[model samples]
Target: MKINEFIQKYRTVTKLVPGLTSSHTPHVICNDGFEMSVQAGQSLYSEPRDVADSYEEAEVGFPSAEESLLTPYAEDEENLCG
Candidate 1:
């Protein structure tokens, strides 16, 4: 789907980065959950289409479950020393 169409469908923020050879593909950041990068060769005026397995991917690599569970407690201990 096109960039604008994707924006309309998802109603998210889209960013376009200009590259030396060509403008980079548009990427959308969703308000509710995740970020999506529009497929290459797609244009803003093309037909609206859903990206395959689009919602399954995550842009940022988050900490593992164990790390995440302990991070807050570790921070709290450091804060208490101040």
Candidate 2:
């Protein structure tokens, strides 16, 4: 997936080290929920890993880092709501 697509899903892209991030190449999000921009190469290719289980974005809903981080607790969320 492209970086834009990845941003659409995982909104908050937590950088490992902003200072180390480079401008060249494409940036992608890994399955582990981290955005790789620094020293990213063609080998990394272009596939944005989807991290959210059932997380959905509303028409105007802007997902926050905290909200996206809570995706792991999605199962527990259903239990609570159920």
Candidate 3:
């Protein structure tokens, strides 16, 4: 799924299970109550070798090193007005 679509879906699912926070990177609350992060290009059967898939696709449209890091600068601030 696209990044925007993934964010929307994740927002809805997280409500049922609290302690879930997904900002720039997608994450989910695991069955054991721990958190799991979903990297780009990940599917239901994601593997360690899948890292490059998203990077390749993204390059065709907007080639940049930005996507290499998930969280943007603004999102790094823990306090809004600090």
Off by over 4 Å in 3: 1-8, 11-23, 41-82
For TM-score, the strongest prediction is 1
Q: What's the distance in Å from true for residue 38, model 2?
A: 8.4
Each candidate's TM vs. the true structure? Answer: 0.23, 0.19, 0.22
Model 1 ranges off by over 4 Å: 1-21, 39-82
Once model 1 is optimally superposed onto the true structure by TM-score, how far is the C-alpha of residue 61 displaced, in angstroms?
Answer: 16
Q: Is candidate 2 or candidate 3 better by TM-score?
A: 3
Q: Please give the RMSD to the true structure for each candidate, in Å.
A: 12.4, 13.3, 14.2
The 10-residue segment of model 1 with minimum total lDDT is 56-65
Candidate models: Cα lDDT each = 0.36, 0.35, 0.34
lDDT of 1 at 77: 42
Top-down TM-score ranking: 1, 3, 2
lDDT per residue, candidate 3, 5-78, as tens digits?
54446533222235432233446443455443444432322232233323322211121223324334234334
Runs of candidate 2 with Cα error greater than 4 angstroms are 12-82
